[model samples]
Target chain A: MKLLESGVVSENRKHIISFIILAATLLLVFPLVFDIFRLNLVAKYLSLAFAAVGLVICWGHGGILSLGQGVFWGLGGYCLAAFLKLEAAVNIANEAGTDQIKALTTVGLPDFMDWNQITELPYIWYPFKSFPITLICVLIVPGIVAFIIGLAIFKRRVSGVYFAIITQALCWIMEILFVTRQGWTGGINGITDLRTCLGWDIRTQAAQYTLYFLTAGLLLAVILFSKKILSSKLGQLLVAIRDMEDRVRFSGYDVSNFKIFSFCLAAMISAVGGALFVLNVGFMSPKLVTIAPSIYMVIFCALGGRESLIGVVYGTLIVCFGRTYFSEQFPELWMFLMGGIFIVVTVACPKGLAGLFESHGAKALAFLKKFLKIENLASKDKKEVEA
Target chain B: MSSTDYALYIENLTVSFDGFKAVDDVSIYVEKGTVHVVIGPNGAGKTTLLDLVCGKTKPTAGKIKFDDYDLTTMHEQDIVQAGVGRKFQTPSIYPSLTVFENLEVSYPKGRGVWGALGFKRDQEVIDRIHEVADMIYLSDKLQTPGELLSHGQKQWLEIGMLLIADLQMILLDEPVAGMSVVERKQTADLLRKISQNRSILVIEHDMNFVREIAHRVNVMHQGKVIAEGSMETVEKNEKVIEVYLGH
Candidate 1:
């Protein structure tokens, strides 16, 4: 009881409870309840949850509204997909029987490159040939991009709606680049036919199960990592920056540097999600790296309660499930339904599902406590009369 | 006066907003370990002078030297790191943070990105926060969120934030503008206590508070300093009485 009364301890207890609940659902219940196919879908959703978590930090806490998270996500997805596709092409080349087939396969070009009739591979794609390099690229590429962007705008003190618009434009530019450079980027279809990673076939049901657990595990780790950041003084500074930017500046902090750190951190986390996404779904498409999907990612964070890490995981799950269910049942109206839900959530509960739970959850607990106290009193009175 | 004996030395400080000078040729020298108050009428650019010294507004021409550091060339945070602190006209505490957090963030350490992330709330930091809170009369409200604080409490909290930074020089812009009589008296006493070791430059309109705390006073009229002396000397000056005190 004394431990529970301590604010920090109780807050930590709540987080631990939420984490355990999420872990139980993702690791145990979902795998048992759903078949391999449905489980794969959950993996896909969890992958996107990475971006949602990043948004919780960047947008919710730091007050940096990035409308182009998809760019970082795509950066991660493409980095891994490029590596996997190169390996698959190498396997094909090794198995080629005819000289004509051998000539194309020997070049070690992705299929899209061949389709474009490019005789030589682009120098940019060389790094992807090495798996280790690809892994490093997945993390750092997004961070570097975010760093440059952050330095340019944040240092200049350009933020709020302008920053959001700039990010949206960046997403548009990436989409266009991906679509036009069909030879390099697989054009509109993106990099597909990823058969294996280091000779481990990813298409198998066993692989799918392993990938699901990996995604869940990674998501939990990301949550814990984000929690660490929020628990630190840096986290308090972020909230302080959001509320009073100038005060933070005058308090001897380089406010722009903190903002840049947050933006870069968010981008890196989203990129990790993107890499996992490619592994689960076996494709990285230009379609995913556009403004619409990027906005949807923001919606996931907003609906989940941008401030709550656990809430965002639930927000991602609920929204993704809704997307699948609606698309299946009302394919024509699903888009409208999703839009309506976002508007409703924004209007009715601006703080998202986490806010709703916080306000109502406390009241519900109090009511339960009162009911238990009354029951205990009646039982004590009966015992006394009997004695 | 030699620059070494003064904590802040402003010379030929001029800031023009599209040809109209908000502060024109304003020069004031604040001696080390003294409370210097700037008293002026509305539109007299008293606040603007503080803004120029603190790097909130850049001077079109002239030098602002704070203990050998050229404040005119420094950024806002760098100026702060150079041992100078400024409080705005309004209370600017982080509303969501507790009174303790408000002071802790201002504790001068962990001013960098990585530094803040690795900063530990050790006994030293806690002790400093409690000490500042107690000084601001918010010791009992350490855990209370800043937004819940009364207006006077918020003002004190902002002052406490600067106190925690332990800056060598402090600039205060109307620190007691909206404060009640009791709150103003507390602030006057707080200023006198804090001014023992450091230099303070305050812009205030209250004559009683000014007289109570001002070790030296500069009276400004229409973007320029008209008189400089002790409170009684400045009050007795014919020019100061004609332009400001008469109104």
Candidate 2:
């Protein structure tokens, strides 16, 4: 009994160590391997990977596939963009004298709003002027939206493909609303020319590097927190609810509350990713918050092995990088090729890289162990540290 | 007993789908610490009766009260929280999780989202898990995934899950439907053992198994109880024999 218990504990330790090593590599390795431009792109991809991580738990583990993650991501992105836009507006007014200020704006509106012939800053945009409020909105807006949606849908027992379709429609609705509401959002042009965040001049290469590290650090922390939730009793209930929802209910669990909580948490995580994304990418557009990107987010979770957090990170990086590479090289054929990959991956490996690793990863690791002639990686490191 | 001698009180319950009555104005009472088996032919609305009581199906009229709680207005989870546990016709366990986890999830503590996040499998939980595991003969398969268990073992695991919650009443639908002869006998024994502490409402087709475990038997026909008595008395009931046995 004692030996059996210790074996289980050791296996958990191995997984934890592997996760830490992977996170450390992600955090430190890219800066050494790539220049600022490439690292900035990586940071951008990691930000999307945040939404993918949420998908891993909410859709993969909980069996609630949300095809509208872009709504939350967009919400978060726009919140930050609005804040930066407000900062730029204030800066513009300050630089220009009071005489020029009256000439520059009807009531100190954003340049885009002025260009679109809007005189006054909207009431909603007033709150974004405060950085603290913007930060809070970035997290709270998406969370509250998700909570209400989850409450309405889950309480009525709407789930599976129906839930996915409803969320997909929600993405399209939000996208259209953002595009058509020109004064509120920047419409087709989006909130652009975001030059500074709190007078820090974010366009500089040094700022880019700092943002890259910060995004990496934040992603790593979210992954660890997600990992903790996945290992808890709540995680087991999620699987149980996924397999047999009625059974979980029969066992005295408020199934809808669990669903709501997970959806809300996923939304908040995606919002954080979105805010960081705006910081790295320097823009927030309605185009990024549509059904297509939302579906792409689902595919990111799928290709990464919907079940594996690290697999999701790699999935997002590989797919995003591949898209950029292919689009630049082939342009027209990239879409065809990407579509083919999605179809093949879905058909061939439904569980994604995680499932593949589960079946073959151990064999590959063992083969490497024998070929390298370096005793067990885990114990060897332990022995070295002991010595 | 108190004012209510029954653990489960059903008064003129009726459920209709479209215009057809699935469970018509039927009333049944299950005394505390007793096994009350409902035996009927197919489409006799036996399962629907159990469903209405467990809040899986809402009745068109009448009331279901579990002890002091009016269960007709409660949701399935709330009914369970009110100390009613239900097992479906099929073995509904999380196939990917271990047998221990299958039971651990139903331990009735730390059930909410935040509570479950910090729930640790302390010695008390572990001990209860082991006790239930031994009772269900799943102790050896504690670490084994539920999918690996045989159908009978899976059924036992589901029952063990309900037991871990410390329920006041248990509802079983076709508990021995696919069990082997030996497995059926063991299930009967298990049901008998569990009924010593709480009320059990079983919907069974196998008259022999019902005969083994029933303290009182209610024979139903076409959505209404045709006979209600001890097994010996119900077997001799001409209406029950004709509708069910057809002799």
Per-residue CA lDDT of model 2 for A305-350, tens digit only, reads 9988888998898899889988999998998888888788889888
Residue-level lDDT for A192 in candidate 1: 92
* Top lDDT prediction, candidate number: 1
CAPRI level of candidate 1 = medium
Q: Show the colliding residue pairs in model 2.
A: none
Each candidate's DockQ score against the native complex?
0.69, 0.76
Off by over 4 Å in 1: A1-5, A98-100, A103-106, A368-387
> Listing every candidate in turn, what is its Cα RMSD in Å to the true structure after a full C-alpha superposition?
3.8, 2.8
Candidate 1 residue-wise lDDT, B1-247, digit = tens: 6776689998898999999998989889999899999999999998889888878899999899987899999999999999999999999999998887888888889989999999998888888888888888989888679999999999999999999999999999889989999999999999999999999999999999999999999999889989999999999999999998988
DockQ for candidate 1, C-alpha atoms: 0.69
Clashing pairs in 1: none
